[model samples]
Structure formats: structure tokens, C-alpha cells
Target: MTKITIPLDNPTLDDVARHADVSPATVSRFMNNPSIVSERSKRKIEESIRELSYVPHAAARTLASKKSRMIGVVVPSLDDALFGHFLELFHSHISTEGYTTVVASSGYSSDEEHIQITQMVSHGVDALLLVGLARDESVYSLLNKKKIPYAITWATDDLGEHSCVGFSNHDAAVKITEYLMDLGHRQFAMISGTLKGNDRASNRLQGVRDALARRELSLPDELVIEGPIGIEHGQKAFKLLMSRSPRPTVIVCGADPLAYGAIFESKVLGVEVPQDVSITGFDDTWLAAHLTPSLTTLRTPQQQMSLLSAEYLIAKLKGEDVDVPPTLGVDLVVRESCSSPA
Candidate 1:
């Protein structure tokens, strides 16, 4: 007797269709939305699939029906607290709508984002959610070629080419700056993430510029330090700022991470927050509230934004016209870290 090996190729939809004596289209329809299929046929197809333990190919079904019920979300960094919040909320919302989410990290690199987008499309994602609009041309070209439903989050534009669901970083930052300015903060220093590839950071920097411009004050190159949104970066930037001839009385951080870094550095340098030097951060993360001196920052709807973005994209995927605006709004949260300039 000869022993034969059975390959684990996984049973496809064709096996279910054959067992049920129905066409592949019917099986596909039943899998995507069983409500559309007749009760008897659905039962038969499902039973057959269970008997064979069939697992359908995502790509084949998508090619046939032009849908995958899987939404892809691409973000800059997954290690950050904000992005982690985004992933959690997005997953919750997507699951509620009978859809799934696939997340990919771009690591703050356009090339990396492009590669991730390509891989996502190949995996048969019904739609895509990008962190910001700043990406390589190849990304847009691929989206166009595949006609994928995509939405830009964390940033927005006036144009209605695609759906956008987030607040304007420029406006939010300007509001925060204006609030600080009203407290008599004249000299300013900014510890910002690299603005070259990140639209959110760039827009925030522009808002800072616009805010200063209104007061007839200008931000010089010396006052701005561009680096990673890390504690180490913030510490180095703060040290460099302190070395200036006339140091800034207030420091504005691009994100909460940077703000925390600045605060840590200030403490290490024998400076008291809000007493020796006022500090403000963007993205009112939970850590911001839990810090020794709670960070004064803009309250962005990170979780809500994630849910709304997923809802809008899923609606678009289902051929429903969603009336989501281009930009969501943000609020300002004043906390212990910010006060009248010393």
C-alpha cells in the first residue's frame, strides 16, 4: 500500500457552490450579505461550506463582486499613543458594521506608506483610510487604478474628491496659540516633528506662523526645532532653546509626546512648569491629563474621528452616500502646564 499526502490548499467557494448545486455568484452573494439570498439556498450553501471547512479566497471574491468588506487603515507610527487610540476606535466601529479593519504602519516614510498601500490593495481591502494627504504620487495612482474607496483622516481639504473626516490642524493650532498669546506669551519656541512629510505637523507650523503674523511678531529659524516627536528630541530641542540669547518664555509642542519631553527636560534642568516656563501641547492624550502638571493642549476627537472615518468609508463601500464634512472640529483643553508667562 502506498501512502498519499493531502495538500492543505483549503476548500474554495466553488466547492460550496458545487455541493449546494448553486452558481458561484449565489454563494458569493450569500457570503457577503446573506439577507439577499433565499433562506433555503443560504442554508444549503452554509451547510455545504461547514461540511468541507471551505475558506473563500479574498481576492477571487473581490474580483468577482468588487467588494471585500475589509477596510485598510494606514498610519504614520503605531508606537505613539494617538495612533494606538485611532486603531482601537477604528476596529470597534468597523466590527459593529459587519466589516473588518486591516491596519498598516508607514513609519513616517512616504515610501513605506506606498508599499503598505500596495500590499493592502492586493489583500482585497474594500476601502482605505490614510492618516494624512501627504503621500507619494504612486499611492494616488494605485488608488485611481483600483478605484478603491479611500478617505483622508487627521487632515482635510476643501475639495470633495474623496471623503475627509478630521479637524484642521492649522486652525486648531492657531486657536491654541491665540489662547496662549492672550495670556501674554510673547517670546515663543516650537519643538515640532519633521514637517517635510507630515501634513498635520506642517499645517500646525503654518498656524503658528499665522498666529504670530497677526501680532506683528515673526518666528525665526532659531526659534523652531524640527525633529522626531520623541522625548529625546524634545529634551535636546529644549536644551538648545535655553541656550539662545533671549530664551522663549513659552514653548509650544507639536504633540503630547514632545510636550512631555519638554516638561521632563525642564524638570531635569531645575525649571518648574508654568512657573519657570509655560508649556503647551497638542492632542490632549490621556497621558497629558495624568502628567504631574497636566498638559494644556487641544482636545482632538481621536477615537471619535476614527469611528466617523470608518463609518463614512464603510457607507461609501456599501454604495450609500454619506454626508460627512471635509473637516471635523477640535476643542481647547486648558490644564496646569500652561499659565500666564513668567
Candidate 2:
């Protein structure tokens, strides 16, 4: 038996040039300005590079360009589908432009976010992706001092001084609330994730109130329940809501997970959804559409915003002057979970 040894040096431009019978400069031109290379020569170089399993040295490229090909992303948790989807979309777009993402979870703590940002800055991430504009002053100070490019995501504000790539949380929530109100849901109860540290949650609650205020309806102190972001939190909130003498005809959840919990709890309590009480949620995750009775939710363009955020940050890091910062729209998805007052 004859054993053959395979070389592991991997292919480089010189190797590609040798395989294609061209100079190294031709291969470089093919990579940088393909338009200048002859079509036949371009095909030969690409084919050779592929056949040789050639991977360009990223460190060499970074050394030549003085750019760290990493984007830092900070989020509260990886458990949430919205954030998970955002991570997937964000990384996919950035990777196409020769950048990688470094993600850190802040554990729903503002202080933790500050620490994460500081660490990411120390690691020299080219840009940062933050969920909302609710970080501590130190985080902003660090970014400004380092001149690190960043874009606030998920929640949009009209008065955002920094570049943002998201839809208006307040507006989206208000639109959803108005749709429910139009269904004649007057006695309202809310199952909201804790709003102490999340601007997105706070803005959503405010949007609900803003719409309710239009009809002189508001979330009563007893009717409003706050808990951590989860279905169990929604279950607890639902239990609380049901304890009222004249229970609310509708329940508004800050997120789809919480809404699912509320719906699940309602089922356990033998309460019929939308027949006895209508429920609505924000951030239409994939499961929202597949639930027993499809959830009426706010169709937030989370993936679009995440992709655009990565694109804009990568562009800024590459010194490209973008004429417009990316911003996506959110729409209210009316479904079976919500209906006219029972």
C-alpha cells in the first residue's frame, strides 16, 4: 500500500498564480478589481483557489488595512427568539462584508451592559450593536472617547442623537393598542416584562397608555402586572388579572413569550381565549403564527433591522459615508387571539 502525504500550508496568491500561469499581481487585481482582469484569467484564478482550498490570511489583511474585522453585539439574553433571530440576521449580513461578530449577554442588567461594552472596547471591536438607548452614561462615554462606531437597535426614538436602525417602538405599540381599542376592549389589563431597565418595554407600555388615554382608558394600578420576560411571568400576570372582581376583557403583553404564557394560563384556568378575553402581544415571533389560535401581534421587522444595523456599522467602519441610516417599519398583525369584547 502506498501512503500519500497532503501538504497543509494552504494556498496563497502565489500558489494561485502558479496554478493559473499568471503573476501574483494579476491574482491581486482579480481580488481587488475583478473588472480589470480578463474573464478567462479571472475564471482560472478562482478555480485554482477553490481547488487548492485557499483561505486568505485575515491577520495579514487586517495588518495591511488597520481594521479589526469584528462587530460587538450586546443583548440581554439569548433565550428570547427575537434577539436570537436578530443575532442570526446581524451576523449573516456582517459576515458577507468580511466581518465577524462578538456577542455578549448583559443578563438584563444595565451595569452588566456597561461592563460588557467596556470589555468589547478593550478587545477593539470595530463597531458595537446595542439593543436600545437605555445604557448607562459610562457606556456612551466609552464609545465617544474611543470613537467606536455603534448603532442603537430594536427600539427607535424620534430624538435619537446617535444613528439608529429600528422602528419606532412607541408608534408600533400605539398602533396595536388602537387596534384592540377599536375592537371595543375597554377594561384593559397588561402583562408586561419589567420595564425598569428596558427602554423598549417602557416605550411599549407608554404606547399602550397613549392609545388608552385617547379613549379615557388607562391601565389601572391593580390591573397592571410586571414580571421578568417569560411565559411564566405572563401566567402569573394572568392569574393576577383574573383575580379582579370585574376582570379585564383584554390583556396586553409586552412580548410574544409573555402573551403565550398568558394564553397558556388562560387555558389551564379553563378560560376561553378571545371568547371570554382577548389577548395581544408585541414582536411577532415565528411561533406567534403557529399557536393554537394565531396571536395578534406587532410584526416588528426585527431581522430587517438587525441586518441593516450590521450593514450600516460595517459601512461606517470601512469609512463609507452612508447617505441614510437604515430604519425599518413595524406593523400590527391582526389575528385570532384578539377580537371584539365578549
Poorest stretch of ten by lDDT in candidate 2:
1-10
Clashing pairs in 1: 166-328
Give each model's whole-structure lDDT: 0.84, 0.83
Query: Quick one: best lDDT, which candidate?
Result: 1
Summarize candidate 2's per-residue lDDT along 77-188 as a digit string, tens digits.
9888788888988898877565788999987889888889899988778899998888777777889899899888886657657788887888888898888888888998
TM-score of 1: 0.84
Best by TM-score: 2
lDDT string for model 1 (69-99, tens) is 7889888998898898788888888775547
Q: How does candidate 2 fare on TM-score? A: 0.87
Compared with the true structure, the alpha-carbon lDDT of candidate 1 equals 0.84
Model 2 clash pairs are none
The residue ranges of model 1 lying beyond 4 angstroms of the native Cα positions read 1-31, 34-60
